[model samples]
Target chain A: MKNQELPSLNYVFLLKQTTLEQPFISIKMMIVQQILFVIISIVAFYLFAKKASEIRRNILLGRDEDLTDQSEKRWKNMVLLAFGQKKMFKKPIPAILHLFVYVGFVLINIEVLEILIDGVFGTHRALEAPLGSFYHFLIGFFEILAVLTLIAVISFLVRRNILKVKRLSMAELDGFPKRDANTILYIEVVLMSMLLIMNASEGAIMLQEGTGNGFLISTMLAPAIVGLSPESLHLIERICWWGHILGIYAFLNYLPYSKHFHILLAFPNAYYQRLTPQAEMRNMKDIQNEVLYMMQPELAPPPPADGSQPATSAFGAKDVKDLSWKNLMDAYACTECGRCTDACPANTTGKKLSPRKIMMATRDRLEEVGTNINQNKTFVEDGKTLLHDYISVEELRACTTCQACVEACPVSISPLDIIAQLRRNLVMEESNAPQEWNLMFSNIETNMAPWKFSPDERDAWIHS
Target chain B: MLEVKSMAEFMASGESPDVLFWVGCAGSFDQRAQKITKAFVQILNKVGVSFAILGKEEMCTGDPARRAGNEFLFQMMAYNNIQVLNGYNVKKIITTCPHCFNVIKNEYPALGGNYEVIHHTVFLQQLINDGKLVLKDGGAFKGTKITYHDSCYLGRGNGVYEAPREVLQALDVELVEMKSCRSKGLCCGAGGAQMFKEEEAGTTRVNFKRTDEAIETGANIIASNCPFCTTMLVDGVKNREKEEAIKVMDIAEMVALSLKDQ
Candidate 1:
């Protein structure tokens, strides 16, 4: 068998011959496999699209913000921050490991495309004839990446569970978050193993046919399976192929419900990132108008002839719907990596405010609102809000607005924006500020300073 | 005493100064911060750069009110200040407070107030770069171990980290850096209206944490740019009872002391 010319196409034909004794039966089996693959792919994509549109709808429920300016700058930000993973390099060790997994995930999807084509058309190694040796090189590179991905996934799992990284194990990640992170890691591990095993099994049979010399990493494992009966080897190969494809579909649907959604959303989040200086909190234009109207009564809009007062907009965000759409998108784009929490001055100093938790709670509440909208075809008041129900006054007050968390975020999600809005609602809408803050506000209003000093004495420093 | 002119005084004389020195509330009233104002003014005067203060016309930039969530008061104050500033045709302004610098430069524009706002450290750095202000070799700060504190508003807030450090570099001092400086620099616990109210309960104060990092560098002087950070670090030093040995001086004060005699 080793002495045969053994063209790559002949290898697939032989694979079919060994799997089914009769040609007619093998052709029938191929049709059945094709139909099964098509049905599964349709269902997986349908479910994914359904959840993804629902998420889109939920994000759009937020107040509109115009982040469309500077298209070139936004595109550059997306390329550098999202595609390049520039911020991740702040911690070099995990960054390198994560890069291996990230690059592997992207590159291996090309192999997935090949698998899809094969499953749909009932043809094996379809790209081999056209590209020839480059195809062999591609698979070999993918095989090496698969092994690296496996190592990275396992290291991540150990870091999360055994090593117990402080950020990963924080109380905010207690139940579903913890499980979601580990589950994603475990899924990657299984998926990469399936790919490796499938390649190895296929390489083993190809070696017998004298056509498998270039599957770099898989060729090593191919020998252990070389002694298996041809029937068993073909069955193993088919099962791994189906498992790898199905597992990918499962992962796709799971993304809408997991922190792993950042993989898809990070690009758009980076593009829509606030492009102002970090400490520049957005001005309240409505409040400015109100002050203007007060200063110049002629600027105020006249009352209706029916004597109804004009509807005033609410001061700041009290719930998810009040937040800007970008804020909601920021929530969904969070990777749950806890880098924000780790860098939070409030959280690091034993305060209740974790910027990561702010993003997470915003996401959770937004999801709940989305579910409510899904059930009633419109959001009904749930008698709870993000301000008081999800985030506490203590947590909101603890923020220094230091921009540490904002700077620390790898994906450019600003938890500070949401925090500022919520804090605005707390103070402006509810007048719920600390006694000292209230005193400070009053002094500023009356004395034109935070302290109880006379405006007459503002220049006293000059004479002194 | 230096005869500091006000914008009103400059206007009455039918002349506008080159810049308006925005003596913030802290610089005007806070006793300790007044020294920073005087030092900055002395630098401007020594450089023969004509500048006037808003003096009694200057109001709070409403930074504390806005950060503490009182946008109404902040806007009201902003409106009045913009009126005064615009009335004066103030094209360029300089200040020693980062909070004021951040608000007036970044936040005031939307309310119809725009100016070329420069933080005093950045202004001093410009003066040094332009050769208008020369530092004496082996000045008072020479041979001293000085660690520059990157104030939240001035450093990460506005990306003005290098100017203050550059000003420090010109002092012939050994400028040691804290463990986290520049973009990763820790807050002095005085931002976001934290100065006006008590900090939320925590294991330790943020300023103490920041001050400890500065102390860990074994620097005797913790040089800072923002007045709020100066007060916070001063208190942090006092809490550690290291006030006798350690000093928190503003960059302006350092520059004032290190200026070459005419």
Candidate 2:
């Protein structure tokens, strides 16, 4: 190594030197670059925060619900479902590949923290001295993870495009949904490549100086670039460094607009997952009260002193706003993996019902409502609701409510909840049920059974 | 003929039975389901377990009504049934219908009716576990191929997968499993009140698809735990003209036949 001194402002001379002792850039240029980095970061974060708050406000537009009970169990669910990826293990092949990308993406971001600090403070390898040999080991481990992530991403891209996996290539994913998936894969490829190239060029400079950091994968590629001039190598390193950081910032902001937002929302979604038995549908308390008032008049609350009639709440959800916040959050947290649709009995039998589409439609309608609020300061009726507008009556009617979709969701989303609610609206609000269901309902109302069999003969089975 | 007592008779005698045998609508009215009701009653009698049926007082539990999206009707039925149940001071219930078991156990509590509701498969497993019920060695079903079809309400609905299989194990029959069993078990297209109405347009019926899976197992008998599943699977088998080759029988009926002392 050369003398341990801060390099002076001779850019060409500094670039020609192959010593690891000096900072990558001179102090004056470092200060200028630091300011640029700060501005870019602030802008990126500001944009992300703005969109994030809008999404929060949109989610809150849903009807009030209390999912905060059982905090201990909720925390366990968050850890198991989000952190542990327990449900993803249902399918082992993709699960293993997904584990690679998920673990790699998360662990490699530790190196980003160093890049961030170096960007802000004009230092090179800020964690290197503090962490000592451990820093090299950490970078080497991250390099191995990066290579694994690369392989996973490539296979995922091929599965989505070339081989066209059935669940992924479904018609609901046509147009922007398809593009969003492909774009995410492409972004991962670019980010991982930029990181590798930056580390390789840096390793080449260190190799010439006999002070390599011994990053596992990149050091092997460093020799290919060793023949380049020192200045050229340094230029390549700086360009890749800037490219990688900028790409990360861009990806961060893009998350709120893409299905990849699940990366952020999955934790809260898991924490707020429904803890009830899948067999139990949420009771209609309003209907219960309505019956109570009629059955036992003593249990009914007295009328207002002023004699104004109480406003009757709507029977069930007809639009996104009528749904619970957890349901809306489920929409945003959906990975569009289509496991729910694949497991749906109606979909498997070739009915029009696709549970994945239910989530996507909910999200799309919610976005439209959010934009309406943005422009008009409040939602002015767009004369459209989530029920008949986005999802069809055929789709809603086909569901057996067997909870296969709920059981199949890796993220604890209950598309059945949304389906049941919409069906309630269709029946009670619009009286749009099939004639056979109408007969059955009336039979239960009158004869106390779904069929017209007399209650008198309920125990006649003993005679047989 | 076996003598069956009613809750009214027990009440008039100044005594309450040990458990209320809630014969659901299907068990009461559907001819095919009536056999399951009879088989379960036979087991209860053979074991000397005191049980009483509501008889004339029994009504629907509103499982289908609620699932069919008629909340008003469902609540009315549930309210009236709760009144009857609470009046009788019923403590525990055993039902041959998974739908009734699920609704009364899970959905009725909020309406102020709570009881320890046990499905018959689970009850039979308990009976066998306690040694109150014993299977004959090499009974009629011994070594017979029987594939148990999991009911949606019983299996994934309430996680009562093992009790049915355990009961089958007690029978000493070869319990073959379908490709999808337990938590991943497919529905028989009879849940969510789909039993009453026609299924919406699809390329194939849900029950037909499920029955094909069951038949593909090559089990001579497709054993079921729910009345609705039994009805749907039977229809599917009949549709494919495989009813003669593949028989759909409830677990209770299987147990009633294989009883050691029968």
Candidate 3:
């Protein structure tokens, strides 16, 4: 009987030793996992930066422009457009919901700091002791925001997929854009769920320790999983915690490849927006130089030799490289919200003109150019231009230069400028203007009016 | 009515005028728009302001040419007009057309043609404010329902909304507003040189869409400030077979009808 009791006592001792050693083994494992994720996060950042700078270099391949005027006004515009979202309020319902997601997205990122600290040092709830009671409040606040983000993202998904908003379902948004939007929504939903699961599991462990503070969401969720043993709760918590951080790192890298790149580009895009009056059209300097040479030769420089000008140096944009850097940046900065197209008179009137398409085509052509450079270390002369290859002449001519697109843009992007530049190419370089336009041009050249009548006969109506 | 003098006539007589009337191409050519020209001239005569017309020497302001993307022609016409105006040492200028107003006031300064350019609506508003042009009590348009169509040039292009509205107010008419007005105004479908070119295939005509908004106001008269807008609105009214019911008139024509002399 004494020998049997001794064996059972030894068994109890063995169980206690294993239970005590569990944390030590996990600490070692967590350190290894932490190093792995850090390496992965670094690699993801490197790739994202590489892709982002490639885009920047490609945009700079375009002609140099001076959008640097009115710095004070530009800053104010950025504040109003990007931060204040002044134009989003035009549709109040979506604006309010989007505000929730936007705010949640920014605020929730703060937790990533605590996560990195805990992951790196193998500390459990490292901030809780330092933060005291505030940690519970912080977690509760994050939980609330997580729930809101989930709701907002789901609603957005429904709007795009279920409600089938016409703006989202347009022909241009059919392929990658449609999938890209859904991917971002799904990512948000997953991330938000992981956060809740992590908190809930943590709450279960705290309850077993008899120290659960009963934070709102986690406390509510804890009761359902409270029956689970401590070991299972710890495993669940560890899995969710790792998944949430990994998902965030992946999302950071995915932005440069997505239309959601606007999340990072919108501020700078608004900061560099054209500061001139809405009705004003930019005067082409090359045309202005030629006009000065013709009208006031004394103020103009001597004309260059016929062959001195490069064959590639056309009057206006024939390709992405002929556009201003700001124009390319505008394309990269498009939120794919379709507000410009919705407000466009040409589009509204059933014309084959959509400002949204113009931006997307610009981005697509830029990507093509970028790929060409990546393969050849320079442009390979693809025999395709943004002009006839991507955007047609019919679409260019259909624009009224009404500036509705510019006005309607929540980010202050001006698709009209792109239209005007392309139109300039057609008129000045290609001489490909519509027949009526050519007739009117000649009429003005000879008669100083868009009519066949002589200038002297202009006053005929007064006599009649 | 006072006879209007030409800049050539003013130059020959060595008589300087207070203002130069830049009667634009449509005002000088379109028969309907010509009446607006004459009406505005009569107001100048009634106000006894020393105004002169460029007449035969006046070239187009090159608004339509520039808008049509013909920079060469625009510069040629602009330079010619600028040369003539500067040669006369002209200072203050007013025009009945918003196209002329926009180009001369905004585009001309860039091409070395700087002058005090004013739209006829703003000028007429000033004249009324100065007590130079008096409105008659119970005039032709008095108590009549009028909806002012915001021309792209005068309203959106130049941000001159109050002047036209104020002019309508002086006529003692019931000034009703369309749903889209002021900076949010719809185009008359004649801007950007569309007046001279056929419109591209579209779901609906912008002018007719705008006219429908005006018609929705239940106003019998559609007041306009620009010749292009007047033409488009007139065509819009005719298309809806509301021509007999709705009279499309320039603000100048409306003011002329409400003048003490008329």
Candidate 4:
């Protein structure tokens, strides 16, 4: 108390005043609520994780011949990229603020564990006395960080609300949720602030109640609680605590279905990043050899019809299933953070392609894949492919494959490979590629240069 | 790890040469680029270097084609070039165009194309290092505050920013830099096959922005390496109406100055 610390949280005093704090929560209801929390969480998390794994296997229908080499390399880079927050670091303000929120949220999980242990195990005074100092210090620091993060999020909202929301309509593209989306984000932030204040208020109530075991901030709020009776103070604590836990519950459940789905995808996606630098163009085998192989289709054996192709099919993703496994995981890890959209030359230049949309498209395709998995169907089984239906040919062709998205991706997803594979499928398999590309292909074949020169003229540019 | 044992290993399989030079597409194809290349060759020959040519056997190094989203075309051209080079076992590579140099040095390896690649300016600088190359008194470039454009392929692709600058620096001329140069250098609208494809429809091409940055320095001589950059910037100069005051030159063209007295 003499430490000149901010008012400490008098958790012990608040808990001891069972008459007021425990109101409406009979022992029977408490037991039922605890059971529901445990059971529901276990089932939801299990289903989500299991569904993710199942969808992954179902989608990874294509394979590169050098799968081992490509995969191992991608995995290492993805790890570095996600854990290091490399892309976030590219934009300083949002990145640092996000880092604070991210770390604060993660660290706050420890406080949740403490609450559960004390609440469920009757270890109320157990950790409090022994880890009191350490616990108090962390809670204090986390509250301060939480407050800062709240402020950052509030400004983010105002910027989006008072400023960016209007600009959204004038942007070259559409589909951005105008007011409704911003409203939800604002609500999320508001809820977070409420949780912090409630926790801090509880701390104050304890300190003012003369609970020597409280932390500085909570204890400081103790004086503020002096005006209220024990009953009212206790009531406030229960309301805040329940609201905080429910907020956490709702957030976890809703997150899997959100654009920030990268939260779940990031870990696995990082472990499966593209091993190759996007700038280094990979060389396919001899053109004549490919033509010769294509001519002799009898010699080439298609794999068993389990929907899996032979790994050596130099033919790139002939369909959605042809994408590498990591590509599927990458769709999940995409935070939709818009760094790629911001950096995209095509998008910035008013081209139809937004790298952000491409990532989102991939995610939606995966969701479609998830839907299709139980039905034992392929992405292209119905002549209505997920990619063709989701992303337009113009958007696909618009990509220069400059690896801007690859470079911009914080999770290290190789969108270029996916796009290139789609191109391969369009050009080679179906002849459904854009007319311009077909002409360009013909020009290169006939004239060696797309400039429509003679084959002999290829070398003429050398001496001109 | 990488070394130029001798040019004779590829050219004649044992005959030593005073210098090994690489003549790239721009040098061989484009009229102005050919002029610069020949001038560079003339200077090197005058310095007692016995050089050889790949002649008509060379196709596009696949730099432009591949960057433009046509990897299929690139591989075809690359495969042919690799076979041709290994046929002569061509070693000790040198190039006039930084784009060609980059492909020959870096991009080729993935496609089985590897050689001891150096841009012409670096080779010229080496000749200076060995005290074999000497500058002619072309005088001080008219005190033109020259701004250097770090070609994406040359500077960022292979980290060859200094060699070209060294050639400029040796001339005792003014050397101003673009705001965005070197690793962070903006593209001149030629990268990623952009030279072939229509540019993203915008008020100005990215290269136009780059050229403007260079022009901001008020330097008359805008230096570049890759022909794509040179072509774009030269047009930028004319369209911007700075042509009367500004000119674009390659490092090879500049190095030819050292041999001007030849």
Off by over 4 Å in 2: A1-25
Candidate 1's C-alpha runs over 4 A off are A1-20
Worst 10 residues of 2 chain A by lDDT: A1-10
* Candidate 3 Cα RMSD (Å): 4.4
lDDT of each: 0.91, 0.91, 0.84, 0.63
Query: Per-residue lDDT of B157-201 in model 4, one digit per residue for the tens?
Result: 566668778778777678988876665566676665556656645
**Which CAPRI quality tier does the interface of model 2 achieve?**
high
Q: What's the TM-score of every candidate structure?
A: 0.97, 0.96, 0.91, 0.80
lDDT of 1 at A116: 86
Kindly give the stretch of ten consecutive residues in candidate 2 chain B with the minimal lDDT sum. B64-73
- Model 4 docking grade: acceptable
Q: Per-residue error at B254 for model 1, in Å?
A: 0.5
DockQ of 2: 0.84
Scored against the true structure, residue A341 in model 1 reaches a CA lDDT of 87
Give the candidate number with the greatest lDDT: 1
lDDT string for model 3 (B174-217, tens) is 99999877766777878778888888898788788888999999
Q: Pick by DockQ: which candidate is best?
A: 1
Shift of residue A172 alpha carbon in model 3, Å: 2.4
DockQ, every prediction: 0.86, 0.84, 0.54, 0.26
Q: How close is candidate 1 to the true structure, as a TM-score?
A: 0.97
Clashing pairs in 3: A349-B203, A350-B203
